[model samples]
Target: MDSLTQFTLGAAVSALCLGKKLGPRKSALLGGILGTVPDLDVFLPFDNPVDAFVLHRGWTHSFFIHALATPVVGEILVRSIGALRESRARVWLTVFLCFTTHAIIDAMTVYGTRIFWPFDPDPVGVGSIFIIDPLYTVPLLIVVIWAFFSANWTSRFQSWLVAALIFSTSYMGLSIALQAHVENRAETIFADAGIDARNVFAIAGPFNTIVWKVIGQEDDRYHNLYISLFDEDDEQARVYTHPTRSDLTACLEGNDAFEKLRWFSRGYFGTALQGGKVVISDLRMGLTPSYVFRFAVAEYAAGNVRSIPPQAIEGQLTSLSDDLNWLADRFVGQPSVRAAEASGGEPYGTTETASCVERQTSG
Candidate 1:
């Protein structure tokens, strides 16, 4: 999830764990910092973007790392803060909960965390909630602020914090249920269309129950599907067939960089050929036109045309449906026409918005 959500969750958990033992102010402060510790890997300098991408959310977010690191962190924190002389076990438990809570919250989103790292490197993404959901964060923030002002480790305060956590966690669970429903519906749609596919993944977008990006595997290629959960009657499903090496052999003939990017993106890519050069995008991160960094054959283009030219990649690619029929057909297994329509909707999956939020926060 986003930083604010993690921070608030950490603070809330910390406050509840240390209720009365260490005042609300101290608990929130410590918890907020500990909550953000897992994300510190982003600051590490890497030699290349690929290394950074793979290394990030690696060992730091692992369950084993949290188990070993939390006690040391808790011990240091207790000694420096000098508030909770609690046993090492108690401190370790608190720290573990705080860290695990952070990881669990992250796993709920599309950009999953490697919770069982060194054991499972593949991201465990639930795609139930958006990374930054105001609905989830605002209430938690309200309670944390209330706790900060009250500074009273009373039962009432604990109740508020616990309630907020329950509400958010419940919502997360509901989102997962909803995704399953959407996936079943999508399967029916494909079956009706006579398309053999498996391993369908559905993700709910931020602040809305209507939009989702569905990815499924068919034969040697992957299919990108956009569905609107709210509209169950629409017959317009935007489906894109991502080219496998067999599909791209003609296009990417002698291009090594493009091949490397394809490998980097794990075959989840979109390409735009302009001015005799190719611009590739990894759609797993949402569909901002500029989200694609441009690389060209050095010999063909004399002067620089901007790595990813602004003019070449126009509107944001998304799967938003204003019509109910399209939504209905997308879910519940109905036959829908497979044609590209001009959709002015925001792209279904990607962390560009989160990046914008991070940038704003950093600024």
Candidate 2:
């Protein structure tokens, strides 16, 4: 989730837990600061943009780290402010919950959190909600602001905050249930179309339930299917396949960086081949034509028209939306280790497919 959401959630939790003791203003301030702390990983240096983006939501988000570090953090915070001298255990408990809740909420978005760091390098993504879901954040923000101004600090204020949290959490649960429903509908659609695909993944787009993307794999190729959840049934699936190009496999295969990127992206990538080069974009970041990490691949060559190089293709691929629907679906559902096997309906293989592009212009 974004910083505002983090701050609000943190503030709300803080106000709920400590408002009675610290007063609403002080509790909200403390909660907001703690909530925003985990995301500080973004300031750390990295070898590249990809590394920076990939390594973010790491260590600081870990439950173990929170448990071990909260006491020290709490002591420093308490001493700096000269506030209530609450028990070290109680202070630490509040800090732990505030920090862990921040990470847990972040894990529910498309860009997930590495909450299980050291124990597991893989990101734990739920993909049930967008990083900036107004439906989830606005109500909380409104209540927190109202509490801040009114200074009532009454039970009604706390009750409202709790109710908002419950609503947001419930929405998260509903996203998972909706994902299952979308997947089943997609499978039936695929069967009717005579497409023998095994793996099927569905993800909801940010802020709305009307649009979704489903990715299904058949043989060595991955198919991108876009569906509208608002439709009466699964009658609106649009399918797309990767374009045949040597650069697709050449760029992605046997490349450790690309492999890690793919895993991190949960295979929701778009590729383009131009001037014999390839450019890959993770579709999870909306349908923008630019790579999230500006320097993930080589730059485009000037004035060259023929023999599209792998790098150029990769750049062009940024503009395409072949699997964007799937990316949206995956972002909402969080990528499961068993997703590939369950959706693919067979043993997963290590083979890579050619990147897809519309048969029109290279750009």
Candidate 3:
């Protein structure tokens, strides 16, 4: 999720926990700052672009690490902050909640977070919500702001903070339910089309949960669809099928960087050949022609593919305004053929090749 949402969430949880001792203003400020601590890993140096991309939200966001550090952080606060001196337990709870909630919410988005960390390095991504959702953040933000400027922690203010927390948590639950509903619908549609449902997954579209973008994978092809809750029961979703280029996977086998991406995407990925270079696209994010992470990892040479250091490719959005317009229309169940039409071109573009590895032919 975005930084603002995390800040507001931390503020709300912290204010609720320590308001009586520290006052709503001070508690909220402390919590908001602590909430952003886990994300500090973004500044850490890495050997390559792939490591930086996949290693974010790692150890710092781990639940185990947070649990182990909670007491240390709380003890420091209790000793240094006069008002919190006698409230060791509450301070601990505040620290734990602020850090854990930040990680939990981040895991809710399509971008993966390694909440479990060392015990389990695999990232957890529910893909139930977007990275930014105003509906989820606004209520928490409003209540936190009210509490921030309040003279004291009155009973009424406390109630408002609690209500906001409840509302936001419930909204998160709702998104999970909606994601399941969308996945179910997509499975049914896929089954009807003679496509397997084993690899089907749905993610909220952009900033809203009312509509979802679902993808179903097969060995050689993948299907994409947009479904809105407002659509009639009998309405048939427009499905767009694209090639997976699964055959090319063998060409880049044993390449460390390529394998890391395959693990990150959890098999929901595709291969592309652009100007004789091999590109890998994470199929889980962005639209059909545009993707969030595409890497040019290898290139064709004399009928063979040779591995190279990974280079992250910037996804091109031909028109942001037009894409948003389509999203708006699709969100309301207004079907259009634009997405289908947009699917008819080569999805990858040419990029400069990097140097490395022995040549290997595609099997």
Candidate 4:
């Protein structure tokens, strides 16, 4: 979720838990600050962007770490804030919930969150919702803002806060259900098309859950299928196939950046050789033509692969303006390409179907 959503959620939860004791303004401000504390890991230094990207939502987001640090944070707050001193248990509960809920809701997005940290570094990304969804955030933001400006924490204000929490939580649950339904439908579609895909997942597209992008992985390639909730039951999403280049991965066997990305994406990644540099793009994020994270982790020299420190690739969104237009049409159940025709590129990213090395050699 975006920072505003986190802030508002934290404020709402805090206000609900301790609004009467500390007053609405003070409790909301404290909770909002604490809510964003875990994400401070973003400021920590890393040798490479890939490490920074993959290691985010790491130890800071862990339940164990939160639990161990709760007493320390709670004690500090209880001692420093006179009002909280009288309500030790409530203060502790408020602190704990503020941290835990942040991590839990983050796990709902496609960007993975390592809530378990050291015990299980493997990211937990439900992919049920996009990072920013107005549908989910607006209600909570509205309620939290209302409480923040309220002169007193009245029963009506408290009731609205609780209602917002219930609505947002239910919306999260609904996203999970919608994801499952899309995945199941995608599996059936793949079977009908003889795709032989076993592992498949669905992610909400852009700002809405009505449009979904389903990716099904096979051995050498993966398929992307876009479907809309408003589409007719008989309407089938067109499948776009993209290569994974598992064979090229052997050359990068010992490369740290390569392995980290493979682990980070849970095997949904593709490789391309561009300008003699080996570029890897996380297939799970962005659409085909533009990915959020792309790194040149290795190079080709003298017909041999040479490992290089990961260098982050910048925007590949030459067709982003067009893609957004397509997304809007797709969101409403209208048939459209993922990328615009004027872009003259295949929807996912490129038109090339061959291995990276093959493309270079043939050229």
Query: Quick one: best TM-score, which candidate?
Result: 3
Residue-level lDDT of model 4, residues 62-147, one tens digit each, is 99999998999999999999988999899888899999899999999988999998898798999999999999999989987787
Q: Where is the poorest 10-residue window by lDDT in model 4?
A: 354-363
Best-fitting candidate, scored by lDDT: 3
* Candidate 2 lDDT tens digits, 1-363: 889999998888888877777778788888999999998888888765567667789999998899888988988866665454755556677798899999998888777688988798789876667677788888889877876785557888788888988987787788788777878888888888888877587756656544565767665455656566545445544555543224443434544445556778776665543333345566565433433442234222331212221221222243134345444544444331222222431111122333333221321
Give the 10-residue window scoring lowest on summed lDDT in candidate 2. 303-312
Evaluate all candidate structures by whole-model CA lDDT and list the values in order.
0.63, 0.65, 0.83, 0.82
RMSD of each: 8.6, 8.6, 3.2, 3.8
Error of 2 at 195 (Å): 2.4
| Cα lDDT of model 3 by residue, 22-122, tens digit | 88899999999989999999999987778888898899999999999999999999999999998899899999999999999999998899999899999
Q: Which 10 residues in a row give candidate 1 its minimum summed lDDT?
A: 354-363
Q: lDDT value for candidate 1?
A: 0.63
Off by over 4 Å in 4: 301-303, 340-363
**Off by more than 4 A, model 1:** 219-222, 234-267, 271-279, 288-363
Steric clash pairs (candidate 4): 288-348, 288-349, 289-348, 289-349
Better model by lDDT: candidate 3 vs candidate 4: 3
| C-alpha lDDT of residue 319 in model 3 | 71
